[model samples]
Target: MSQANPPGRPLLASALGGLGLLAGMVLIAEGGRRLPPDPPSIAPAQGADHLKAASHAPLHDARPGRSARKVAADLIAPPPLDPSGIERTEPRPPLGELGLAPRPKTPMPRDWRETLLFRPVATSSAVFEAMGRTVAISGTVDIDPDRTCTFDNTDWSCGQRARAAFNAWLRGRALKCFLPPDADRFAIAAPCALGKQDVGAWLVSNGWAMAAPTGIYGKAEMAARNARMGIFGPPQ
Candidate 1:
């Protein structure tokens, strides 16, 4: 008989072969898992042509051959203003051209009457200063310096006494009278005052001068007449 193979040796060789076969199968599976995916299929000719035309077409028709700077400027620029609906105003015509009287220049304001101070010298019972250039006290009747009055059946120079009395009362005091700016240096019947005392009222109330018909000193004159004061009474 031929020499028989060892039993353990055969079994060990069989195990080694099986292990090598299993290792080769595992390596093949791993290689398949790591492979790249397949590429996509190509498009049709018509679709490819359409895509090429779109890519070459201009973005805007109004701006031909536009540069990058100009495109950026257009993006940031303000919109143009529309002035079609705005209303335009016309200049006004002059008054003379419209057949109307030229607008009268505003008349310059006239000077206001001003109060003047005067140191008067009595000429008569109701007058101050010279005859023609006198400040005749307003609202009073002038008594002539030569006038006479009869009291207790005795004649007396009443007018002279009245003038003397007026002079004494005045004592060279200043009088204030409202006069026009254009007043002339002539006799003017103007109301006057001496330290808040009305000259005309004082004369009429004291009986040194008679009140005018329309004078405001009627009541004062009546009071003086009733009291028989000043010239109304006997000479004193």
Candidate 2:
């Protein structure tokens, strides 16, 4: 047979049961409040307002919508306050000092007939140098070895001798030259004297060259040929 329970013990047991039930109910209600709200009700993204919000949404973090990575970069290296703040060590020189100076203006000739002078770069026995131009001896042909003298049979170089003589005559001399109608040619007559003698008449009378086909020095050439002078004479 079982003995009966004490009256005080039953009351104590009932009160303890009631307290445990109340504590459980309080915990359940607190947990329900703290739990994250059910994820926001997602509206269909097809709507215009939703599309606009998506487009405008920040892609990152503490900087709204900016990525965490970009935020870190900004903290590590801040953007420049002024884009043009950097200084140049070597400043550019002024335009004139840099050889960009303007060129002086040149005066133009009033007419086509007005002549301008420039320096010649090259000169030789047959070519006269002036104002950077050449004036060929108009009536003279170049001397060559074939030109002969009746006075001697020796193989002499008449052309070489003639060129030497011409050069010698030309030294310390100046001549006036005119441009011919042909753009390619110049016409010039030597003055009566070159150096101590008449050099123009000398070259022909001495028989170094022939009169031109134009017959400018035909008389001088004839006189040399008859006298058997220069290359027309015996080889020296």
Candidate 3:
């Protein structure tokens, strides 16, 4: 039919629109066939072609197990620095012993009259030495022969008792506990020079004072009697 149309409109509007729709469909089908099949998709295609992949993955669980391997590998090894390699030295004799006075030059002298207390409790000397690096021990430990020691009313050898007590006291502690002799140490004390009795007895009977690594003397008696402990100061 020759349909009359308005001045503003084209006559076969419906037919033309239909034809355009058919062309679009044909183009789409053709292009799809011409394109390569999509690479195996792990996700959805975009614009009907490209696809999206998983944003989340399955989490793996850590095995809860105890094994010898874990224990062996977990251990940390200790660092080594040989201390014996370092050269060491013995302490110089204290100046107070100008010739062998048996005591340092201190103003404080031993008070053999009960001003001090003597209660010797034995412990590992090595342990004490290791803990307090600066600590030292000095006493009448090295008295010469002829010095009489009485134990239970019998004469016991001075040297024998000193050696035994000294040795045993240091037994059973760490090897590092004992310090090498001759370390330049400050005698907070010096050895005691007991004339008649043993160190224990003398110390008790004459209440004396001694420094850490120096001498032991009757400090209480000296101070009271104004006896000269000599140059350094009273035995600390």
Candidate 4:
């Protein structure tokens, strides 16, 4: 057998191997210590965090992947339009002026012939100058053309003088008349005045007309008859 390795040399070699292994382990540990700590892994928001972010975000931002311009346009209100798609006046009045004023009067026609034509509707009623206008003698009975009054053994047509005078008066004036309560556009009102005189009462009191059967002016008619005025004159 070869001479055994020198015992001292073998023992020294074994010790050197163990020491080298130990040194290598120490170096590895030191290298690990010198390295920076790995950065903490960041987890994306989930559940409550995600919901909280959504709540706090701008309204337009909540939508996924929309561009800023598109977001802005979506957030804006649409232009107002009617269902029929036609442009029209605003239904609501402007805040500045609320209550409306009266409308302007309608202008009349320039030509007299184009103006409203009036005619007699009855013995005591006439449609006056304007269209759709009329006047009634409030309390007088119309003179009956068929009725006769005796005076001096001759018969005179009833109240012919009164009729003639009334026609003459109307021919001279420009008429502006008014309507009374419960009266229509064509109704002759009782208080109708022609130049400050009540035509009906004047006619009756002057014995040129008779009181209505309803007796609105019976006392006056009776007085004229008793005085033998007008057609009541005794057979002359």
Candidate 5:
């Protein structure tokens, strides 16, 4: 046998269902109202150095070989900061009553050029001290072997004429200038005898004008045409 629900109890259950649905809607609306407004975003502070470094691509650090050029460039454009921040120590004077040791002054590093030539931190022990932008060489050639040289001198003094031929050979180049070695400083290696006369003759034949020929061999060589042609003054 099937039993039916009481009419009064069925009506009460329907009313409770409607109230639950309405209460859920109200709770949802109330929750939406309490949401706060969107917050602002904070940006990071950036340094100019970062942007500058990023702008340039990588470059080989040629700090050792081209020191002069490097120093000159540095003097023009200062570095972002001093790599080494150590302060230089000042020298102290003698104490009036109790004499004390004077503090030694620390030597400052040379600019790029000095560092290149003087402070060459390299394997080869070659130290060069030069003034300004040029290197000066002053030394006597070993005269023992320099005195006599055997050469083959035909119509063209192979030794002297050879030099002029050398100059002409250099002239053949597209370079701005080329200097032939002076007979005195640099002698021709020939199969026959070479004298002062042979040298002067070579200069004349090779389109080189003769300066007043001094009897001295050394003087004559000094008058030779510039090795690099017009690059530098006449040969020393």
Candidate 6:
């Protein structure tokens, strides 16, 4: 028979093995604590690229990686140029170049009815000269300078006497006459006044001149006729 192994020897060997296993476990735990945690897992660039590509894809195509930069550029491009051509218009010619005469100005109606001042020379019982124009007193009948009147069945030159009397009253005084701007140079029927005295009124009132059929001196003429004054009276 073999000699029996020592129990103490076997037990001591098993204790040594247990101590080695414990030391190995402790070393592993300490190493794990000392080491920096595994670096955070890096995200792959493909994930970001996939998102970017998806955003750029067209909605209708459903494809995930197609770029729309060229389509977007075309959508934002400027409009096409206009096709119509510019037309030039001709300028109008001046009146002088066109040989056209200038239109004459028309006088205002108010100006034609204005009153005029003139120094007059008595020409007869109802006519006078002013501004180199002969004017007859309106509203009165002019008596011829050679006219005659009969009183007591005797004829007398009443027209000459009336003219003389009118000249004496005038004494070369200035007169205000209402004459149209286009009055004729000859005997124009203008109503005239000396100071505040109406020449026609004086003539009709004194019976030196006869009142016109449509004149305002009818009352004065009647008074002169009833009084037998001037031509209605005896020659003076």
Top-TM-score candidate index: 6
lDDT of 4 at 146: 56
C-alpha RMSD in Å of predicted model 6 compared with the true structure: 26.9
Instruction: Order the numbered candidates by TM-score, best leading.
Output: 6, 1, 4, 2, 3, 5
| Residue-level lDDT tens digits of model 3 in 99-215 | 565544544343312111122232322112333333223442233223344434556454334333444543433322122343325322222222333333232223222222333
Per-residue lDDT over 29-67 for candidate 5, one digit per residue giving the tens place of the 0 to 100 score: 798565577985434455566567778966666677643
Better of 5 and 6 by lDDT: 6
Model 2 has an lDDT value of 0.58
What is candidate 1's lDDT per residue for 49-166, written digit by digit as tens?
8789989997765676855446666569987767997788996776664675654543323562546555578989988863234678877988888999887898888899899888
TM-score of model number 1: 0.50
Instruction: Estimate candidate 2's RMSD in Å.
Output: 22.4
- Residue ranges of candidate 4 with Cα displaced over 4 Å: 1-132, 174-189, 213-216, 234-236
C-alpha lDDT of all candidate models, in order:
0.78, 0.58, 0.37, 0.58, 0.34, 0.81
Over the stretch 139-210, how does candidate 4's per-residue lDDT look in tens digits? 676665455777767876654455555566666454434444433444554434556666666667777677
**TM-score attained by model 5:** 0.14
* Alpha-carbon RMSD to native, per candidate: 25.2, 22.4, 22.1, 23.3, 26.2, 26.9
Clashing residue pairs in candidate 4, if any? 136-188, 151-235, 151-236, 152-235, 152-236
Tell me the lDDT of model 1 at 117. Answer: 55
Q: Estimate, for each residue in 167-231, the C-alpha lDDT of model 6 and write its tens digit.
A: 88888777888777767545688778888999999998998899989777787999999998888
Who is ahead in lDDT, 3 or 6?
6
Clash totals for all candidate models = 0, 10, 35, 5, 15, 0
Which ranges in model 1 have alpha carbons more than 4 Å from their true place? 1-112, 130-133
Candidate 3 regions with alpha-carbon error over 4 angstroms: 1-136, 139-141, 144-147, 151-153, 172-236
